[model samples]
Target: MKLDESALAATTNDLTREVDARGVADLIEFRMDQADDPLEQLAAYDGELPIIATNRARWFGGKASDTGRLDDLFSASRYDAVEFVDIELETVRAKEWLAHEFRENDVQLIISHHDFEETPDRDVLDAIIEQCAEFGDVAKVAVFPQNQGDTLTLLEAVNDATNRGIDVAGISMGEIGSHTRVIGHLYGSKLGYAPLLADDNDYAPGQIPLEKLASLIELTKNERVDGQVIDTIRSEVSVPKELTLSD
Candidate 1:
């Protein structure tokens, strides 16, 4: 599935409420690691929303702890509904075998890394983006921002990566850095993630509801109708695959 010119939101639950409410073309994230029976859930999911599977590891603030986590991820990619799979940069760098396996499966990979502590310096962030770009279809980085400067740093990284023709999703976590979600898209971020349910059960810090984010992005794009803002927003919302699954 292609990820271009459309808003793809996230759904934590196995339901399709978020996708329906926001009128988004895709669901950018489904935290498989958090599910009791991830494979079963995937198998039973007949909802009209394409999924981007993510079984993040504990090192990356995810609940997956089994030694065979990577193996499970590789298997999940085989599911026809899974258009994109998020693999941590650490795993991609350490496990060359898994990297090749993803390539062999013809599954799109999103090499991601999260820093819950603090955002890195400009050069450091750039280097990380470069490394992830080498291996995955999209290079994603989520960093915690201590202050406004840290948020700006993330914007710079997102802009720089997109300027260099790299597909990137950059965000700053935490209360102080929440606005990065909207601004990131303006700065050329290819994707944004919002909760399926806008309640307190969201997986990420400072995440807004899918509908709100879609509205905000639309408003921002409308305000800046010139340049590639409209195209970028459109790209962020398009779904590469059909949402329905046949039995």
Candidate 2:
């Protein structure tokens, strides 16, 4: 199914789990780097879900090496099931022409950035999203947040870019930042990646169980929070405490 806007994708290295992921996941993130004969699997795929193909390289906290990486992703782009393909922002910036190559295949490109160490300050984060937006159909970033404050920084950056009409997605990794997985969309993250099954190993840190995430997404959508409130939370001090009134 084609997404009009944002999507909640089930992340998997195995395509066989697609059937199990149907009810909760809106799309499949086929991890080429972690799977065996990924192209072969894609060729044989009969699943109903559209795919967001990813072949994450090792330097960016994944298993795949750099050898022939772009070639394989380009090949993945040819498959009918692939609606989107993810490539690193660094790679795209250096090669420059690769974005044109992917779009020519009729698939959107999601230019991604990963900060395994720490979340950068807000200005840098916004800059990263802007840079990704300039070349990609969507700008995606994943950062390791040391505290809740860092998650807010990421959400603000995402919201700032999104409010500018840029399609963007962001996630904060590790325990302290897991809450971002559920709420980042409310702040303008255009994609949510959770495992196909609760028991499946997470491709990234702090991923909630798929079913739980779906439920929370449902629950959170009803909140009466406004854009101005979120902007206030980001800018002014004690916003959270002030909002926390006594029942």
Per-residue lDDT, model 1, residue 182, is 74
Report each candidate's C-alpha RMSD, comma-separated, in the order given: 13.2, 6.3
Tens-place lDDT per residue, model 2, 1-247, is 5445568999898898799889788899999999999999999999998999999999887788899888999999999899999999998999999999999999988999999889999989988999998999889999999888998888888888888988888999989889899998888788998887744566998988788898898798987869998898778765465486687
Alpha-carbon local distance difference test for all models: 0.80, 0.88
1-247: candidate 1 lDDT, tens digit per residue: 6667544557574544434543553664778777777787777667666678898888888888968787777777887777788998998898756777877777788899899999999999999999999989899999999999999999999998998999999999989888888777888888788876554455889887777777777787786445687778887886558676566
| CA error at residue 10 for candidate 1, angstroms | 1.2
Candidate with maximal TM-score: 2
Candidate 1: list runs displaced more than 4 Å: 15-22, 198-200, 224-247
List candidate 2 stretches off by more than 4 Å: 1-5, 223-247
Clashing pairs in 1: 4-235, 5-234, 5-235, 6-234, 6-235, 6-236, 6-237, 6-238, 7-236, 7-237
Candidate 2 accuracy as TM-score? 0.88
Candidate 1, 143: how far from true, in Å? 0.4
